[model samples]
Target: MRVLWLSSIACNGNTHSFLNYPYMEQFLNDFEFIYHPVIDSNYSLKEIVTETIACDILLIEGSISDEFKRADVPVVDIITKYAKIVKKIVTVGTCATFGGIFRESDYKDTTGLHFVKEVKIDKFKDLLNKTISLSGCPVHPEVLVNTLYAIKKSVDLQLDNFLRPKDYFAYTVHNGCTRNEYFEYKVDNHKFGELEGCMFYDHGCQAPFTHGSCNKILWNEVNSKTRAGLPCMGCTEPTFPKSNLFGTKKNMGIPQDLPLGVGKRTYLTLAGITKAFTIDRLEKKLFDD
Candidate 1:
């Protein structure tokens, strides 16, 4: 398959994530690159982005901005050109999937390819059926590789309403976290630098409510932000990087946001039961080092 990477109003974080794909050579062997910003390619930026370029898969990164121009031509124009020819469009980050963090500046002006923050863009409405979204701040490399492999194998992927492949996004980042034990016991870490507790109750760790199997797939084959004492920040969701990212918003001791699909009363009942216990194992620090 011929794949081409396109950047809109972007920082190229997804491209960096793609470059760091663990099985780089194996992935490259399966696809032909017509043009890629970071990789050596047969075509130049101008040629690859033109209306006539052949592309089996168009991988888009970054949020679409009406103001962004490339050599006097709007990025949206290039997107229109490619969208007409590409067999399938893969929006590789939350930016191109759901108008991510970049949209905070001007949400009305920035948007994703098909749906912009859960709403569809009528201009590119025809492309919706052909689009696949892999939403993340900097998309996980494994998802990119696996999605490509699935397409190459012609395997049908179970997709969510957002057009994201369910195989990778079905589970939350909290699904395989080491801190699951702490979360289960309602033992939350009040501070930022402690590894002995869960960040869900106190910190703005939205792993339980956010989609994406970050903990299960792992980042750098080693760690995730939540595992490294940082909160999940809900990068995969439309409302990511919420105003107060370090602290969880509570209204009368109840978190403003509950876990995905969980009712507030149900959560409170479970929380109340769990909070009754002070498991010594969870409260005790493992090591000073």
Candidate 2:
């Protein structure tokens, strides 16, 4: 399969992240990249801009705008031209999937291939059948590779409401988190870089509700943010890059956001019960000097 990667109103973080994929040799053997931002491929970007490149998969890596142009050519024209011909269209980050952080500012007209922060872009409605969203600050490379293989084999992928493949998005970042035990007991981390408590109660952690397999799959196939004593930033959601990211927003003493499918009342009841008794092990540092 031939893949063409394009960027618009982006920082090219996704392209850099994909470069870190451990199995690049294996990935390259299965698919051919017609044009990539950094990697030397079959076609140079200049050539791709002027000519119609035969692409099996069109990978868009950033938020787009009618005004955003590449090599003096409108990005919309390039994307739309291929959207009609490609077998699959993968929007490869929160930016391309939901108009992400770029849309938060003056770029009001910037949008994803199919959405603008939850609002559907009617212009691309016709391409929804073939478009797949892989949302993250920088999407996990494995998920992208797996999705590509699935597409190659004609495997039916179940998608969520956001049009993300359910195989990866079905679980929250908390599913396999190292801090899950602390989360279950409502033990809160008061500071950064600690292994004893859940950062969700005090420090901002959207893992319980944010969809993606960060903890399950692990970043770089070894460690995740929570594993390294940091909070999950919830970069995959449409409302990502929320203000005051390090602090949890609360109503009275209760968190404004609860875990996915979890009710506020049930959470309060559980909080009350869990806080009443403290587990001795969780109060101490995992590695004491």
Clashes of each: 0, 0
Q: Report lDDT (CA) for all predictions.
A: 0.84, 0.89
Model 1 misplacement above 4 A: 105-108
Q: lDDT score of model 2?
A: 0.89
- For candidate 1, write residues 14-35 as lDDT tens digits: 9999888888888889898887
Question: Please, what are the lDDT tens digits per residue for candidate 2 over residues 1-289?
Answer: 9999998889999999998889999999999999888988978777888889888999999998888889899998999888877999999999999988887546558888899888887978888999999999999998888899999999989999889999999999999998788889887754675667788888888899999999999998899987787878889998877888888899897889999999988998999999899888777777866
Best by lDDT: 2
Q: Which ten residues in a row have the lowest lDDT in candidate 1?
A: 46-55
What stretches of model 2 exceed 4 Å from their correct place?
A: 105-108
Q: Best by TM-score, which number?
A: 2
